[model samples]
Target: MKKMMQRDSTWAGIFLLPNLICFLLFVLIPIVSAFVLSFMQWDMLSTPKFIGFDNYIRLFTQDEIFIQVLVNTLIFTACSVPMVIIASLLIAMALNQQILGKKFYRVLIFLPVISSNVVVSVMWKWLLVPDYGFVNYFLSWFGIAGPNWLTDANWSMFSIIFVFVWKNIGYYMLIFLAGLQGIPNSYYEAVEMDGGNAWHKFRNITIPLLSPTTFFVTVMVVIGSFQVFDIVMLMTEGGPGRSTSVMVHYLYQQAFRYFDMGYATAISYILFIIVLILTFLQFRFNKSENWSS
Candidate 1:
């Protein structure tokens, strides 16, 4: 019996060894390296100099562009996260019903979620071109002038937010659908027996039961919105004079364009801290809510 137990333990360690090694090499090491890099002044070509908190201080005090980028990222998160959650929840509820062609509708909605971000950004850029693009041209037919989407300062961020929310809705909708399906039908039946209407079922039962899924989606959407870069980079390149500049794009500029690796890493750590705090708050609130309920 002892020999067989020892054999099983050996096999378990053997199986876990490769994954453990890979995690250390790829994840843990890189994170530590980046943290060390954040405190140094290195321009890739030069020897790194220990700078302590100067890079972080400069981000808050000296770099005005960083402040704007921070605002842009916050705005993107605030707008896109709620829109994605609400829109996806509504779609999920509708699709959860026994409607005709529901499977096809689900497939159609999910198509954009699986599509390449690069391809979508380029396609939308072409479609939104001011003078000769499909969107503006269609608007012209209705006597409505379409604004220059990628170029106009006011519209550029809005365009990115709209696209981000649209692409993400389908993914969150599926998650919500899973949550909705998990909710026992017996609960709804009991509600009906008590003379509760559709609104009552949704308000009293569905909302509370779906809280976990909603919290997950909210955290993910907030993080994803904060880290949005590819589409913004491809579409507007954080251009039209910083109207659509987000943190990651600005970090990319600092790292690659200027070779300020240390400054860029500092920005990355700041972002990490912000996300960590937000996630911690979410977990705390969720625990409290669950306990109270």
Candidate 2:
């Protein structure tokens, strides 16, 4: 028996070795390197000089742009997370009904999610052009002159938020759809027999039952919103006077454009910390809500 158990353990180890190695090489090592790099000052071309906490101090106290970028990230996360969650949930509910061409509708909605970010950004940029853009042209019919979405600081952040929500809504909708499907129909039937309306059923049955999925989606959306880089970069280039300058985009600029690898690493760590704190709060809220219910 002992010999057989040992053989089983050996086989399990053999099967897991490749994945463990990959995780170490790709994830663990990079994380550790970034942590170490955060304390040093190196511009890719020079040897790293250890300057403990100076990068962090400067980031927090001295760097005005960093503060602005941090605020921008928080605003983006705040606005985008709730909008995506609500929109996804509503769409998921609509899609859950026995409507015609449901699968086709799902495909249409999900196409943006699967499309390349660059392509989406470019398409949206064309659509949002000030004079000849489709969006502005449509607005012109109503005599509402659309602002320059990409060029104006006041509208740039909102434009990015709109695109982000549009691009990712389908993915979150699918998640909500799966959650909705997992819910047994018997609950709804019971609610129906008890003289409950659609709102009542949703509030009492769907919302409570789908809390776990909602929590997961919320956490994911928050994290993803904080890391919003590609869309902003490709669309606005964090321009219009740094209106849409998110943390990751700023980090990329620091690391590559300015060659301030150490400072960029520090910025990355700050983002990690922010995400960790927010995720922890979400879990705490989830636990409290579960207990309360």
Candidate 3:
């Protein structure tokens, strides 16, 4: 029995060894090194010097731009997350219904999500140009003058939010569609027998059952929003007076542009904490809802 158990353990270890080695070499080591580096000061060309928590202390207390970046990140995530999630759910509901051209509509919506963010941002920059852009041209008919989107502090973040929502809705819509389909038809039949309308059916039967999916979507969206960079970089470069400067973009600027490795790593850890807290809140809410139900 002992010999057979040893053989089984050996096989299991062999099967897991490759992935475990890769993870340790690629992920765990780097993450741990970054964490350690966060507490030290280094310029890329010099030896790192231990700085304790001074980087974090400065960020929280003395760094005005850091505060602005944090505020912008929070606002961007706050505005875009709910809009994208709800929009995706609605799209999913519509697409999941028995309608003609359902497959085509799904494909059309999903294409942009998988497309390159830089490419989309560049295309939108042209499309939103004040005078010759297609969107402004259409708006000109209404006699309401269009502002410079990427260059105007007032409109820059909003413009980015709109782009983010437009690009991401399709992906989440597909997720929601899967969730909707996973729901049993028997629930709908029971609701029908109870004289439920579409609204009633969705509220009572669909939303409750779809809570798990919603929770998952919420977590992913929040995490993605925290890390948003490409679109901002391509669209505005965190310009228009830094109004659209998200945390990650600010981190990039600090590290590469300003050569502040210690500060950049500190900013990264701040973002890490924010994401961790948001994830915890999402799961806590889900757990509470589950228990209540």
Candidate 4:
């Protein structure tokens, strides 16, 4: 038995070895290096010098732009996350119903999710151009001139939020669709026998059962909102003077554009810590809800 167990362990390790090596090389090692580098000041061309907590101090206390970036990130999260959740949930519910061309609608909604974010952003950038763009041109039919979507600071962030929600709704819709489909029809029949109507069926059966999926989707949307960068980069490049500049985009600017590797790494860790705390709090809420129910 011991010899057989040892042989099984050996086979398991052989199967895991390739993935383990890749994780260490690509994920674990880079994470550790980033953590260490967060404590040092380096511009990639110079020797790294240990600076302890100065990077963090400068971030919170001394850096004015960092404060704006943080606020922008929060605003983006606040606006985009809820919009994505509500719109996707409603659309998912609609798509879940038995309707003509439901399959075609599902495919249409999901097409954007599978497409490249870069290409989508580029296409949106052209479409949203204030002058001679399709969006503004359409608005002109009603004698309304559209605001400068990317160049106006007031509208830039809104444009980002709108585009982000539009691009991401499909992915969340699929998740909700699966959750809806997983719910058995027997529950609805029971509700019907009890003289409950559509609202009662939805409230009593669908909502309660779909709580887990909703919770999961909420958490994912929050994390994705915080980590968003590519769309912001391609759409506005954090332009209109840092109005739509989120943490990750600013971190990229700091690390690669300005060569402030240490500062960027520190920002990255801060982002990680923020995300970690949010995730923990979400889990705590879910646990409490479960216990209460």
Which candidate wins on lDDT? 2
At residue 292, candidate 4 shows an lDDT of: 98
The lDDT of model 3 is 0.94
Ten consecutive residues with minimal summed lDDT in candidate 2? 221-230
lDDT of each residue in 1-293, candidate 1, tens digit only? 99999999999999999999999999999999999999999998889999999999999999999999999999989899899999999999999999999999999999999999998899899999998999999999999999999999989999999889888899999999999999999999999999999999999999999999999999999889888999999999998999999999999999999999999999999999998999899899999999998
User: Which ten-residue region of model 1 has the weakest summed lDDT?
Assistant: 218-227
Point out where model 1 deviates above 4 Å.
Answer: none
The TM-score values for the models, in the order shown, are: 0.97, 0.98, 0.96, 0.97
Residue pairs whose backbone atoms clash in candidate 3 = none
Better of 1 and 2 by TM-score: 2
Q: Candidate 2 residues 1-293, lDDT tens each?
A: 99999999999999999999999999999999999999999999989999999999999899999999999999999999999999999999999999999999999999999999999999999999998999999999999999999999989999999999999999999999999999999999999999999998999999999999999999999999998989999999999998999999999999999999999999999999999999999999999999998
Cα RMSD (Å) per model? 1.1, 1.0, 1.3, 1.1
What's model 2's TM-score?
0.98
Please provide, for model 4 over 71-146, each residue's C-alpha lDDT reduced to its tens digit, 9 standing for 90 to 100.
9999999999999999998999999999999999999998889999998999999999899899999999999989
Model 4 / residue 277 / CA error / Å: 0.5
